[model samples]
Target: MKFIPFYLIFTLLIFVQACGNKQVEENKTQREQVIAVHDEVMPKMGQLKSLEKAALQKAEELQNSETPDQAKIDELKNLASQLNLAYEGMFVWMRQYNTEDGEKTPEEVKVYLDEQLVLVSKVNEDIKAALAKAEVLLKD
Candidate 1:
């Protein structure tokens, strides 16, 4: 009978350990997802700067023209602003993101990662939208 009680305790311990491991794995997966989104957009930082500069240069050139199109100059300037905003957004996200678990529990870590994924995903969208708009504008 005593041996039976000890076996039950051991089984419970094993189950608890397994659950903890699963939680850790889940957190790892979520972290990876956040990083994936960040990686997708990070390479575009340089492009964003280049596009912003190009937009400003085009706007300036238009402004200097004898028959300057004020409307087109305004549009190019606006596009430059949007590109700069998107570029800044990435830096802001990187500044605020924390990868350390510190004293947080697994559940807390999961929540933090979830929030980060949402933020990074939004940043990704902003980057893509700005890049697309710039491309369309500069193509002309």
Candidate 2:
């Protein structure tokens, strides 16, 4: 059997190892971004669904009244604003995750998605808190 040169063989081995490392790094980043996206989106969706139900109920009651309580009206407006903020924030993160640029490096995309996820999650919490308060105010 013919023998391959030692340096050439070593260089090939190093190249293969580097390729594998790169793939592993890419996969780690992808998984992290996916998790972050999940955390942010699900809560926002939950907040929206919860608030929508509460608002619809109040709106229905208002329509039946000659004068809707001013506090309830204000509360509904606030809740609506919160909902829109969350909705818009979700779309922002979605754009990052969805790769609108089409040429963003995977790492850059992941960073943007991850950061957006955190910001959106915080916004979701605010929306949820606002929804809870609005529900009580409207019920009064």
Local error of candidate 1 at 66, Å? 1.4
Model 2: residue 46 alpha-carbon error in angstroms: 7.3
Score each candidate by Cα lDDT: 0.96, 0.64
lDDT of 1 by residue, 21-91 (tens): 89999999999999999999899999999999999999999999999999999999999999999999999
lDDT accuracy of residue 62 in candidate 2 = 81
Which runs in model 2 stand beyond 4 Å of their true positions?
1-23, 26-30, 36-50, 56-68, 99-110, 119-127, 134-140
lDDT of 1: 0.96
Alpha carbon deviation, residue 64, candidate 2 (Å):
6.2
Task: Give the count of colliding residue pairs in each prediction.
Answer: 0, 0
Best-performing candidate as measured by TM-score? 1
